[model samples]
Target chain A: MNPASPAIDTESVTALLERGRTLATPVLRAAVDRLAPPMDTVAAYHFGWIDAEGNPSSGDSGKAVRPALALLSAEAAGAAPEVGIPGAVAVELVHNFSLLHDDLMDGDEQRRHRDTVWKVHGPAQAILVGDALFALANEILLELGTVDAGRATRRLTLATRKLIDGQAQDISYEHRERVTVEECLEMEGNKTGALLACAVSIGAVLGGADDRTADTLEKYGYHLGLAFQAVDDVLGIWGDPDATGKRPWSDLRQRKKSLPVVAALAAGGPASERLAQILAADAQKSETEIADFTEEEFASRAALIEEAGGREWTSQEARRQHATAIAALDEIEMPEKVRAQLVALADFVVVRER
Target chain B: MNPASPAIDTESVTALLERGRTLATPVLRAAVDRLAPPMDTVAAYHFGWIDAEGNPSSGDSGKAVRPALALLSAEAAGAAPEVGIPGAVAVELVHNFSLLHDDLMDGDEQRRHRDTVWKVHGPAQAILVGDALFALANEILLELGTVDAGRATRRLTLATRKLIDGQAQDISYEHRERVTVEECLEMEGNKTGALLACAVSIGAVLGGADDRTADTLEKYGYHLGLAFQAVDDVLGIWGDPDATGKRPWSDLRQRKKSLPVVAALAAGGPASERLAQILAADAQKSETEIADFTEEEFASRAALIEEAGGREWTSQEARRQHATAIAALDEIEMPEKVRAQLVALADFVVVRER
Candidate 1:
């Protein structure tokens, strides 16, 4: 399961995630059965291996990207990969907790080609599922054995706080008419970066790396998250639907205060004005209209993004962040090959089309 | 602040609730500032001394029942009241977390005579506020000091799981058209009773009580919760609005599947059929013509309850639980008078009105 080769590719990441699932399955499955039968249905559905009737099925449940990040970071930090799986489980649970709630908040009825957790289970049970996951995450962390309990608790608790903080900012931005690029970055940093940072930080802690090494890996993970989000924002507007499987300019339609939009908005010209007009249009505009903005409109918005330095700026920022990540890994005095894997993973994040 | 006081003696309980607020304010206020500014706004509104705009005011926020239960149980357990105040705060936070999410799921737009947190801040922020409260509860429990940290964490974590389990059952019953009175009792026992039990358990833990004493106090809290909820059901069906501040039989109109309704449904007679008819009309009905049934209807339900021996059943159950609790305390070899005061408080739970 080499992270670099396609032979060691998404399937390898899936294998790592599956390893975590196996480790966590017994405790989590039993707890869900005892405490939340309905939510167990919702969670199983969310995992994409179950139908609406709560019966098992076969489907893809994404790459388990975040969990892989956690496990690899731990291994990169010199922790035993097998022992790192529990922390990966905790991170994955937190990720899913946010996703369940986020779907409800965003009014997203569908996810991964199936009805979202809330759309099927309703908001009440969805909320409970999120809560159950949160508790289970901590419960898993507590099983780290007392020797590592305090350190694991500290890292994971702080990560949980950051994830919550990120979500708060994300919701707040929806109502705001304006936002600075800096503010948008801060929001993205907390929302997406914190968890990724924690994935790596947990690795450092479990790998029994020094505090300095742990901190370095944390910075790397954080920057990687920010860069990943920036690229995602770019793809959200213009990526091929065949590849990304998202409606074109869906971010624009929702008036989402994304990074590229923030940059274009700050540029303040005809392009910005047009962008504002499109955003100000009732959000329920038809899909045809959303994807069919005039060529002039598209060109203006593109110019605005370029003029605001969105493309050049975010690209450089991504590279710089990646560099910082790599430098941090070097400072930790890790095995060069392991550090290379982390660095390669960081690059892969920004390079993804979807 | 005396738990032994009669229910009408709101003055003491109110004062105790205020004291719990006072003790919690410094720590919670600081944490809110640091971790979750957006959620803090909603939390302030939820606390009921604030307008939607987050302006402070003098509003009767809530009865603070859970915190009072925690503080009083701690006092009865022979701990210095001040020392256990943090435990009281943790329990109160858990209560509020549940309430914030509850209002959203129930579509309860108003609470404490003001717009609910979700109504004022929207569901997203409200959800985050609940999450923040959960995180803060864990952080506050850690303040019980390093020596006590392990016990505190375990107790709080278990308590949290039980809280979610209770909520899970509640949501499940809502969708499942038919549920027995026994099942309803079990649901409330988990959702509401678990917290009450934890309130006392946490108090005992913080109070440095022996395991036997803590276990006894926990049982006392559990029965007290059942008694409290049962009395509340009585008030919901037959009590005056002027006395209870809510319309009589509101639970019936809402198709609450409360203990009485479950009993009547199990009885399966004309009364049960009529009750079913009313519930079938609308699960959220609340008009007097619909909500409050005739004396015959009330009598029928009461007879069913009596026939099923619910009142006597629960009464004897409560007493048995309390006696077990008292025996556990006796094993601790505490002073007889202190034990008497706690026993009286447990009795008051069954008899309280308004």
Candidate 2:
């Protein structure tokens, strides 16, 4: 590979994501506008479209990665990117819907450098607004009155059920004393991979692509989601505080049994033993003790995980998943530009800093 | 109507409801069975098909009113009852979904003579299982692979959104000092009427009924819902505790701004003024004060509302809505037996004991 490819891919992916967001934003806004006052207002605040006082704000709304993949998937099926707007809008809505509920369930107060919906509007509003967005996603898709619209809606609903299953598993796992690596992967596959797989394939489904092409696209997306999550897990422990908008060792502070930690626990080493002891203490500590823990304590736990080869194992798994995601693209022929953009997005996901 | 009609209608409606439950139960169970463990178990418990220990128990599931409406609607549209199974399952799922969430949001511990979902499982499980049931409702509708399936899905989604809006409004109203009569009715229309409206019409939609027929049937269900809610409000204040399984003046105990209370507040007179003062005192009291208040105190408030004509007005309104609901059937052609069953169900709703 050429040495300059990283710079070129970064620029290309940024343009692609921006273009996808540009196309999908109006459509998303239109559907959200269909909601009544308080729900619409809360949704607007959650989406970074407004402040707590209902004034317009320019806050960040994430990377638009899922939307970009949706648009490109439509293009991959030899349709205009416009064909994927419903897919884009549906996914973004579902993504934010999950974020809203998960935040409340996780007891999080801040997100995107602002107070969360529950913190600002209250938990009831958060639940209702999240439900409203989910209903809107289906309303938008089924209104198309086409066979493809029906199929796409079905796919999205199944993915959403799987997503809920993943959350249930995640919550249950947190309370248990031990979680296997296989169990963790199964949960993440359902939680993260299912929705992304639907996002990428739903566009092709809407574009009237055959089952084989949609299936291949889903493979690409499923692997991409795993890779993205692996990177997120690594960042959760060691990412720069400024870039991530989180405290140092945020995941450890929350007692998250993320992929890296699960893998380290499975490795069976001296460092793994030490890490388990710290985690056992974490599990037994009261709320006050957990809150009183210092960064150095978390850092030492992070260091133990690294010594156990967890960081390396997780990084290699991300690269492996990334390679598999790119390989799925080779199974089907598509426009060269679309292929390039998909590849660029995959690279960006695997290597993103935050 | 003939002198013998009430007895015959009561027996016939009982037979019809039993039939609808028998038909829809397997389909509902199958859809719920598709959910993963814990969620599936929680849903089963919510349906009264199982006990808290996961053992099968004959707990009371509501009367399955929505399912009966869907089946009758399909018969009204000249289709076999089997064609409406999807509609029956979807509405039942959605109804229970709302119940699960509402129980949590309302902070009620008891429902249908047993512990609520949140009381049985934690709040997080309540939230997740409720979410899963909602998703399952859509999945059941869209899997039928027909044009009517698409239309029915669209209708159900809109109704779900309205139901959520009603829940949001209900929560907000609980904190406010006063709620207008019209506001209370509007909220009930969305919360209770919208889903019932969809339940009655969705089956006909699945059977390819015309828009006029669907709309008229919706009118029937909407009015029936109001009648049902009015009866409910009346029972909340004055029903027999042994039959209703609730204390006398239960609505007042919870500070509910139900239809009777709102109407009583709106009527201007000495009794109305006294009722308002009592309500004002009730709202300002602490939890301990509320719990310590004697039954006679609540009984006095009830007496004031009755003297202000709130009880009589609500009963008259129930009759009016019941008449309106039965009248809607005249606008469309249907079998005589189907129409009779529909009328019977409407009568049952307005006069149910619990």
Candidate 3:
């Protein structure tokens, strides 16, 4: 496919995302205010609207990637953007809920250049906030103004289950010493990819696309999720600190059994032995020591990933999935411009650095 | 008010619970198989179905309180008892899910007279089991065969939110030094009471009650829950370990601001000062010294509880709520014998030991 034109700039994406937040904020705030007062402060902290002392914090809240993808998919599939707003919010809430809990379970103290909600409010309060947001997400989904709220909720429920399953796998893998490459991919697919698939699928459903197209969009999202995870795995090991807001090679230091590392270990040889030694070391090593390995080392590791077909697997898989997603959008007979924007949006996921 | 007729034996409740379990076993087992395998061992252990080795263990599973309430309410509200089987399982799963997380968050290592899921499987696995159970609960709620699955789901979602809110309040109170009596009441109302309300509401819905009647049953269950909590508060400070399975005076030792303590403190007098002294002295006392307080001291504390109107107020509140709940059931036009059974169940909440 042709690369997105240079004219598609950050200003436009930011503007679009801001508009989405503007529309969604009131709806979500109203429901949350009515439903969960004790958790309100923590929820606000997660959204970056309030600081630790319950004061305002000024900045962009989050990337808003999931919500935008959801709304754009709906619009591209020919549904009016407004109709899909609830679904967009639902997906975003689910995404954020996952984020809130993930930080706690992963024992991560910081997120987006700030102390995580758990760090600020404690895990107990943070858990309530996450659980509240998830419930509110379902509430919003029920308000999708569709006759088939049941069907919509059923899908939402299934997506959430996938999310939890993915997280379970992600956490389980951390304690595993002999994880396989296949298992790592599956974990990423569940943890990182399932919600994205749910996002597009919800959009397609709300857009009134027929069954076949909706299924294809789901595939598109599932593979996009896989690709997104693969790229994220790469970044966890080698991403620039300024861009990622994380210590470089943090995953390696933690011995996170990410796809790339799992691939290297699964190849079975010297590279595997080196990987094992690093993982099994007596104490934590400095970042420099971990990152200072030879080009031979990096290449061998990368080679293992390549041989195991992670990179090619993710890219080719993404292309095929997006093709299906695009085909689904076409079948719905969406405006060409809307379809183009959706394509640009899907493609952006593969290349996002932060 | 009737002294829980000796005829309503544990064996009958167990038999009914067993039947419900048998009916819903396949869906529950399927969900268990699909969502978690590592947890399979842990969950079986928690349920007292298997030893640590994943082989069978010998014992009763649990009291099965929520499921029994669901089935009984369904029958009382006029659905064939069999019709609400799935609802019964759904409530049981949700109940157990809450227990798994509560154990981890509270750091309690025992549940159901067995090692808690978290204690056996660790926090991470316990978290996953909780997640899996939530998914399974929603999945089972969808199978209620109530024609409008969306409504059933909305009820479940709303109930889930209330449950989370209750939990949030409970945990937040642990860190606060001077929680009010009203706040304590609200916490139990949300946490323990909401699920009871849900069981009744779901039963009514399945049993062909209109929205008003269903809401009434829910309200009744809510009152029952409050009464249940009041009794539980009394037990926390005075419960026999052989019966309650809790450490003696656990709430007092933990400085738990239960209804009686909060009320006593809020009354503000000599007794309140004495409570403050006890709380302060409790901080430095050895276990033996803490236990060495005179029987007169215990009597004085009970008198303080009475003086603050905590005991009288809670009992009156329970009676009023029970009456309101019964009135709601009456408005629903439930059968007379069934209504008597419902009344019996509500009365059991405030009176039962195990």
Q: Order the candidate numbers by TM-score, best to worst.
A: 2, 3, 1
DockQ ranking, best first: 2, 3, 1
Question: Between prediction 1 and prediction 3, which has the larger DockQ?
Answer: 3
Worst 10 residues of 2 chain B by lDDT: B1-10
Order of models, best lDDT first: 2, 3, 1
- Candidate 3 DockQ category? medium
Full-model lDDT for every candidate: 0.68, 0.87, 0.69
Candidate 3, which segments miss by more than 4 Å at Cα?
A: A2-19, A35-38, A143-147, A266-277, A280-335, B1-30, B58-60, B143-147, B266-273, B280-320
Q: Largest DockQ belongs to which candidate? A: 2
Q: List where candidate 2 sits over 4 angstroms from the true fold.
A: A1-8, B2-8
Per-model TM values vs. the true structure: 0.85, 0.97, 0.87
DockQ class, candidate 1: acceptable
lDDT of 1 by residue, A39-126 (tens): 6777777777589887888755655656666667667766666556667777777788888888888877766657788888789878
Name the regions of candidate 1 deviating beyond 4 angstroms: A1-35, A76-78, A143-147, A206-213, A268-309, A333-337, B1-22, B33-35, B69-79, B143-147, B206-215, B267-328, B331-341
Q: Estimate, for each residue in A13-33, the C-alpha lDDT of model 2 and write its tens digit.
A: 889999889999999998989
Assess each model's interface with DockQ, reporting 2 decimals per model: 0.49, 0.78, 0.52
Query: Candidate 1's error at A239, in angstroms?
Result: 2.7
| Highest TM-score model number | 2
lDDT of 3 by residue, A1-354 (tens): 643222344555776667677776776666657656658877877777778788888744766766666776677567777766777788888788888878888877767777888788777666667767877887787655354444555666777888887788777777667788678878777787778887777776777766676666677677767767776777776677677766655565556788667766666666566656656551255646756766565555555555555455545544554455545555555567766666666666556776
